[model samples]
Target: MTKLTKRDFIAGATATGAAICMPAIARAQAIVLRWADGQAMNHPSPQSAVKAGLEIKEKTGGRIDIQTFPAGQLGSSRDMVESVASGALTMVTEGAALLGQFVPQISIIEAPYIWRDPAHMTRALKSPLMDELNKVLGEKRGMRVIGVTYYGIRHLTSGSRAINSVEDMKGFKLRVPEVDTFRAMAEAWGAKPTPLNFSELYLALSQGAVDGQENPLPTIQSAKLAEVQKYLVLTGHIITPRLVIVNDAAWSKLTEADRAIVRSAIETASAWQDAEIVSQENSLADTLGKAGMTVLKPDLESFRKPVLATLPAKFESKWGKGLWDRIQGL
Candidate 1:
């Protein structure tokens, strides 16, 4: 055989060293946590999640690794929940409105006028009531809620025209998430609620599949919904909260040390995301105006009255009056 060149020898040595070092590196490294969200990678929620992951690795001295998949690369919010529940996926960031499907008691957050401001909502979340609810979710649903981040204040956007009152929404085809609370709200507003997958919403709007939809300003801006829609009604009917969750199975598998690192990282991310959402909401009116969309500040109380009148009785009977009272106290 020909003599081995110096380059070949060096390459062979490097390969051998890498092979020997890999197991040690892994042993010292943090367990890799996989997370997926429905928003685009650059969106604030996912961006915050990514930053939090980096912080976790740094804080833990590379003892844990976090990998985030954005833009529904895995699937929609519902699919994410199922995957996480089955331990097929590690974690997901989802909206409370969507999570209502699995745990109906959590839907109380989506009630119209439930919170006067973001601070009120934050306080309510930390209450014993919510802590008990978390236990129910963990014990019954097999998921752990790490933390919650605000999405934004919900608003109505339409292709037809401005919605100034309850009457304006009559007979309108409004797109809603596949959740009962949202559908109920749409029906109470006199609009025909059409459940559509979020991925299909843009095309549906552009093709006239639906006349209107509702979401916060950042989502409207990030998704470029203003480009396809004409009128925006600022009703602020709901203050949306995004829940960060992990599969109970996956969470249980982690060492207690690793769990502590994950929790701390998530708390940091929650604070960052909430502040960012507030700033974005404050600036969104100007942003939407520049995008050439007409923004209407509708009579929010008038819109809320109808939904509030009926929802309490309906939900209290199903869940419990005590739960409703606890939420009201908050």
Candidate 2:
């Protein structure tokens, strides 16, 4: 047997304590990220986010965790985006038009009539154009695009008017998100755009503050707008693209392997979300009709022609020359 000095006794005690504390320290230091979005908790958009976060944790062997705050829980779309930009929030999934305040040209993704349909918009999202825009966004705004999901086709709903043609929109009070592109679209359609926070839209419609509003069918269903709005006109004016953005600071902290895992998980979630949204959109018209809203399929060409003439020209300067053409070509 070997005799132990006081120094040896203290060293053994210290070693045992560290052995017990190390695992707790590692667990506490796990990379936890917060993701915020405006969609409701039950909506496919946020559900997909939760799914992706789970995948990322599993793939990373518990190194990273993403916590999703949906349904404007963190704040409005603009507020959440601002939080991500300032590194106060880790990530956000929001409309490209809202993000346009940071990278102006990205708004083109949500411009009315820019896409023929959801499938066309999906192709454009996968095109090199998105790469160019993503680079610009990261460089200029310190946000990186990790995934793009197809937000459903936007349509008009009303309480007092049934919008069947462009003339019907003239002087109509239409509620729009506080995005310049949405306002521009409303103007081109001949409606008086009323910029309002989305959370306030239901009340705005119910109180007759705005005569009508536009959003995807899924949003109408999730937000229970059918209870307030009387009509659903399927103008399909815009096939909006939803972007998943990570603050550059948060992204930079991950290793290349972990980054790949994160990106892959997000891409998987986005694909699933796209499919789910399209599926929901397919059936929501009937669902809304059952809920007491009159569904209308108007002369879509009447809506398309005016927007094509005005919007492209209006945004081309800020969106860069020929970018619209390239997107169309895609």
Candidate 3:
């Protein structure tokens, strides 16, 4: 990753194309795909996406080409999701929690303390329940999930103050991504959920537009949020996930051989990304602590109990009755 050469990703696989990964994607016959994400260029999400793009190129013999846009170059997460939905963009990286907007059942996984650990997330998502949910979204919203990548256990960061209890979060404005599940999760703990785009989070925190925000450590590090935030509370509230998706139109356009190539490459890239994130999370706290942030591992049960209690009444209607129990059984 440190020494990326032109032939590795920029040069198009088997075709004698220019030394640009996205160069001349408008060729008459090649299926050019746009892979967009809101994470920073240095983040593992984009890095893994680049690797997947190269693999797709190689496996498809240059028949499929992918170009990546990082750091909200396309737009906010909601905007990118819509773009992909409308076929304005071929693909985009989005969180499953946000996908709840279209397919509400998937949001059940995003509820607080749902995944016992990162591994549980992998198993639960790859389980039949998720398969059925994916099928629903595919039939209803044209969403074709290519990969499920691990985002680390989420924690809280604030410019001032430490959250030691649910009482401490009372009335505190927490900046959440433009996703409803987070808003409900934050509200369940009695925090004021302030929705903001991730791309604008650092500035929002630095300028006091929001009191605090929650995200995985790799994101906090890659965004240099330590410069703005002071306290890192390891509540480990939610083990989040990001979905790499292509529109159904794009999927239908692909031949069976091309679809297989893309799916295999995506699975390979997702495994690498998930492993890398686990390694990063293992040590990111110390790195953020060294950056002058106070890191505290509060009593997680205090945070977990309140949020978990709300699911049956809050989400059961949409996610279906006993969905949480079924997920846990998985």
- The whole-model lDDT of each prediction reads 0.81, 0.86, 0.84
Clashing pairs in 1: 29-63, 30-63, 30-64
Please write out the lDDT profile of model 3 over residues 180-218, one tens digit for every residue.
Answer: 778888998899999998988988999998999999999
Q: TM-scores, in order shown?
A: 0.89, 0.90, 0.90
**Best-matching candidate per lDDT:** 2
Cα lDDT of model 2 by residue, 202-282, tens digit: 899999999999999899999999988999999888888899999998899899999999999999998899899989998
Q: What TM-score, to 2 decimals, does candidate 2 have?
A: 0.90
Q: What TM-score does structure 3 among the candidates reach?
A: 0.90
lDDT score for candidate 3 against the true structure: 0.84
10 residues in a row with least lDDT, candidate 3 = 1-10
Off by over 4 Å in 3: 1-27
**Better structure of 1 and 3 per TM-score:** 3
Query: How far does residue 43 in candidate 3 sit from its true spot (Å)?
Result: 0.8
For every candidate structure, what is the RMSD over all alpha carbons to the true structure, in angstroms? Answer: 8.3, 10.1, 5.7
Number of clashes found in candidate 1: 3
